[model samples]
Target chain A: MPERGLLIVLSGPSGVGKGTVRKAIFESPDNDFEYSVSMTTRQKRPGEVEGVDYYYRTREEFEALIAEGKMLEYAEYVGNYYGTPLDYVNQTLDEGKDVFLEIEVQGAKKVKEQVPDGVFIFLTPPDLTELKSRIVGRGTDQLDVIEKRMEIAKKEIEMMTLYDYAVVNDSVPLAVEKIKQIIKSEHLRVDRVIDSYLKMLKEL
Target chain B: MPERGLLIVLSGPSGVGKGTVRKAIFESPDNDFEYSVSMTTRQKRPGEVEGVDYYYRTREEFEALIAEGKMLEYAEYVGNYYGTPLDYVNQTLDEGKDVFLEIEVQGAKKVKEQVPDGVFIFLTPPDLTELKSRIVGRGTDQLDVIEKRMEIAKKEIEMMTLYDYAVVNDSVPLAVEKIKQIIKSEHLRVDRVIDSYLKMLKEL
Candidate 1:
């Protein structure tokens, strides 16, 4: 039988270094997992190609897909739609390719509702103080905006109970190692590997 | 806050290298996990310690624990009572140490019922032929006994669906590495870690 791939959902509070960890995991040869390209209504940034970073879509197109229930989970932020494409993820998994979805708290929840077996990983800062420092260091948001983000982070942390595991992003290398370990361990799940062997044994 | 250790259940067919994998995991200094010493009525073999390999118990004591609902799960096999001690497993978990229970198929299901959050791992042989070879290679069992063990292995493989993860023990090192990964990934579960952080943030 062909090996199966795992659907892993990576989420965290803002400024927990999820992006950096993800990059490290991808860069390491240890991770042959595929990344799920998201569908978004946001305009492509500089040097971002269609279907590479995201499947950039018009609002109407995004809405049409939503109405058709084609999207696994989607949300509107700043008047733009951002969500996962069910077909892409399912296809990758069917090909025995582990797929990683980097999304926010709400998106992760929605994906879980749709795919309960999907591995949910929450990245955390070492401590609250470190989280605040990371947010401040970003220097992109005003004090009030950062405060609001911190508030949101607190709310996201409360939802950690819903996830399958948590990794503290104390160091990017360590966090990436943890993420890789989760993916490796998930593949060992018995339900995915045993039935076929059992059937073969029965035939014998 | 100190990190909490996970409760891991390792179950698989006999001669599938479950013991070997467990040994490797325990031998690793980086693994920092504890094995749950089971309680049983079986006579201790040579070199076996009462509290280390197992808590040797009389049939009456085993029955008493069962009647008192202290045993997580108990069963009679060849006139011996074998079961997991609830207090020991709980105490180890509470101490922030991950507990590994190397159990049979039946005991694994019972443990899962008692601790739904516990991670269940099922080790499997690469194939039936290899399974038979391994059992025979042990040089301890008679032909009839080996045959009976294979029959039991077949039955256990059918119940694979009850497990959380299945790992094929084709290679000892590979299997151990996969298990190590699972333990690491489980630590990253979002709901468990993030929610606690979020709760602490709210209180702050």
Candidate 2:
């Protein structure tokens, strides 16, 4: 049997540097994993590509996939449908490629329900004070939005208990290394390895 | 608040290099975590220290701890009691140190029940043929004992589904690196870091 691939879910509060860590993991030469490019109904920006950035789709097509249960998990944000395509993820794993899904807490929960054995990783900032500073440093949002995001971040923090593991994204390289380790370690699970051996022994 | 340490449980079939991987983790300069030395009624062999290798205890003492529910889990092996001491693990975590327990599948399961949030990692061999070779290559066991161990190993493999993560010990150094990464990543759990910040904001 072909070696099975792992479904790794990455979630963290805003300003935890998950995006930077994901980029690092992708850039690593040692990693051969595939990042799941999600499909969305939102219009692509000037620099975005259809498949690379996202599988940009019409609202009708997005809703149809959801209706057919083809989407692993989807959410409507500002009237745009954003979701993971189940077929693409399954196809990647079938090819013995690990799949990485960077998602929010709600989407992660949904993915877990559908794929019970998927690895769920929660990323966090080094500490609260540092997180607040990072958020303030971004200078993107209005003061009111930053305050709201922080409030929502609190609720998300409580959900960490639900994750399979938590990785602190204190440094980008360190966080990426941790993600690689988790994936490598997960490949050693006996459930997938020992069965073949037992069968071989019986044949012997 | 002091960062909380994770309760990590590592288990796998024999010959999967779980011990070697753990040794690598301990040897690494980045890992300051404490390994939980088990308490046992088994007689200490040559070169084994009481507190360092294991908490060597009398049968009566072992029974006393088990009766008081102080032992996290225990089992009788070769007429000797083998189990984990609860206080040391808790004390280590309370001091902001991660605790690692090298246990068998049964003991790992029991620890998981008691510590629901404990990280359960199962070490696996690269393949069945490699596993068989490793078991036979050990050269310490008699043919019969090796056969029985192999049989038991098969049974243990079936329990892999109970574990939270599977790490294959293909190479000792690589396996250890993966484990270290898992530990580092877990520290960044969003709930802990984000909640700390939210609490700080509330105080303000």
The weakest ten consecutive residues by lDDT in model 2 chain B span B188-197
lDDT of 1 by residue, B48-96 (tens): 9989888999888988899899997777889898888888777888788
Where's the lowest-lDDT run of ten residues in candidate 1 chain A? A128-137
Give the poorly placed runs of model 1, Cα more than 4 Å off: A1-4, A40-46, A56-64, A75-83, A129-153, A194-204, B1-5, B40-46, B57-67, B76-83, B128-154, B191-204
Task: Give every candidate's TM-score on chain A.
Answer: 0.84, 0.83
TM-scores for all predictions: 0.77, 0.70
Per-model i-RMS:
4.2, 5.0
Instruction: Please give the distance, in angstroms, between residue A12's alpha carbon in candidate 1 and its true position after superposition.
Output: 2.6
lDDT of each: 0.79, 0.78
Provide the DockQ value for model 2: 0.30
Q: Candidate 1, residues A103-175: lDDT per residue as tens digits?
A: 9888998998989988888886676535656556676778888788677766656666778887877788888
Candidate 1 chain B weakest ten by summed lDDT: B191-200
